[model samples]
Target chain A: MDPTDRETACFEAGVKFGALYHQFAGTPVSAKNADSLETAIEESIENQPGCSAVSVDIHTDKLETTRGYTELTGEYMDVTLRIEYADCIVHAEMEMEDGYPLMRVVDIVEE
Target chain B: MDPTDRETACFEAGVKFGALYHQFAGTPVSAKNADSLETAIEESIENQPGCSAVSVDIHTDKLETTRGYTELTGEYMDVTLRIEYADCIVHAEMEMEDGYPLMRVVDIVEE
Candidate 1:
């Protein structure tokens, strides 16, 4: 596939992974604690069997304000994580807009 | 040699092209007329020899405000331009922030 396809695949993988992870945690993924979520993902991939390495490439901050409250959340994290199969570059994005938890798998690349 | 290098080279080429084009026109390139600019570029390349095709892939708008003046500008134009010397996919981006003409060449891909 092309770069765009790879990016889309990575994004879908991230979204699926995020959903499964949230279900496993049994709590709403916290946008306020993006770092924690990032760390957890890093740790999981790093400690997993046959994994090579896991690292965060980019973590972006985004803020949205409503009439009564303002949310300081992350726009996206362009992360390059390695696994046993291959090096999977993924972008895990989280956004809280209009009091809604918007989690999206923005990108993935296998190199 | 790599994607990043190609992107950088393309960006530099676009910047040089923009500068030279501006000099030739004896006017500052207007962000307000992005479509016009895009059309001009398309016409230039399409009319040129060795150019298989020329198309504007993306155009974007942006707004910037100063202490007294609210200036509307363009954020960026992610354009994919084709030339005769191979199909050079170029992104011509422009942004005006803080009352400065922040013209940038963001990416280039030769496929």
Candidate 2:
């Protein structure tokens, strides 16, 4: 079936998120760079087709470091995003998988 | 930021797909029930708020069976969906992970 413009835009946003996740997956997470990584994530989502605003909360306050790599066995980031075509909110969580970011939807509810 | 209605709907669809994947995961795959599973997936996506039509193609023609559980080492399903908000197309692929379906975006392009 053919997708509507809004659906297309939403999916595009997800694609962008996936790309960004891969981009920052293996990077070291530390207080010195957490803010920058979060900003990059927020900007990537906001730059999508329908996204106007995005809130990213990276859980880097307690990252365990071994050598030079951040141990992400139980770390996650929360993402709250707003798009331009619907009246609901999108809440998602990005978790570490094989030391890479894997984004999944937590919920979508009316605002 | 608040998500638009379309974004919410799209995320909802993904959630549904994930649930359905879990439901059908570990089930034996064969010609006997491939059609039914595909239908269930399509219906699940189409029932979402913005989705109108969905195409689901399960790759069960060459499934390898061991005991009763289907070995999904290299099996995948393709889903093409349409929603009522954008002029683009959403194409995704679902692969088996630990005998369950894991969906990922392939692309979103103008149709």
Candidate 3:
């Protein structure tokens, strides 16, 4: 069977979450540049189709400064995505879960 | 409604593609480092849940050399992912599609 609108919306939401997390995960980030990274992530994901808004919070406070800068990963950030598709809108988020970056749908509204 | 096994598999594949693309994009890349980046990309995404295999190809020839190294993007690479979930397996691919990295499910089989 073909995918329904709801499922497509969910898939699109998942795409945004994955895209947001991976695209910037390995960037060299230090406390001084965390703000810029956050803004870049938000703008990057917002460029995706169906993505209305993106909010990224990088936990620079948790970053290890021993190396001056470290590769970014889920352990140092949280993200939320708002995706609208067809007649449905989706809210999704990502954060560390058992050391893995877990992306999940928070809610979906059909309107 | 709950997503079926097939839908979940597709979603997983999409996640890997997004993660693979985003996590490595913007990295400093030149002919000298493209092979290593390809290996790193394949290994990184293979760690994702339900992802069985990943193949990444970075086109060193297409890279702009004005700065000696260019950032990676859809225009510079192609990727394929294999994901398995609840007895269903999915094959997905990503490449430059009209100026965007278009990812789509290529096939899904149940076993």
Best by TM-score: 3
Q: In candidate 1, which residue pairs get closer than 3 Å at backbone N, Cα or C atoms, i.e. clash?
A: A10-A108, A11-A105, A11-A107, B50-B84
| Residue-by-residue lDDT tens digits, candidate 1, B3-81 | 2323223323332333223322322334455567667756664553333444542233332323322322223333333
TM-score of each model, paired residue for residue: 0.25, 0.41, 0.74
- Top candidate on lDDT is 3
lDDT of 2 at A68: 43
Which DockQ-derived CAPRI band holds candidate 3? acceptable
Worst 10 residues of 2 chain A by lDDT: A65-74
How high is each candidate's interface RMSD, in Å?
15.9, 8.8, 2.8
How do the residues A1-24 of candidate 3 rate in per-residue lDDT, one tens digit apiece? 345566567667777777777667
What ranking emerges by lDDT with the best candidate at the front?
3, 2, 1
Q: Which residue pairs in model 3 clash with each other?
A: A22-B22, A22-B23, A23-B22, A23-B23
Ranking by TM-score: 3, 2, 1
Per-residue lDDT of B1-111 in model 2, one digit per residue for the tens?
454544544554454444344434455667677888778767865664556777767776666645443732325565555544455444555566687545544444444
Judge candidate 2 against the unseen true structure and give its global Cα lDDT, from 0 to 1.
Answer: 0.55
**Model 2's CAPRI class?**
incorrect
Chain B, per-candidate TM-score: 0.36, 0.58, 0.96
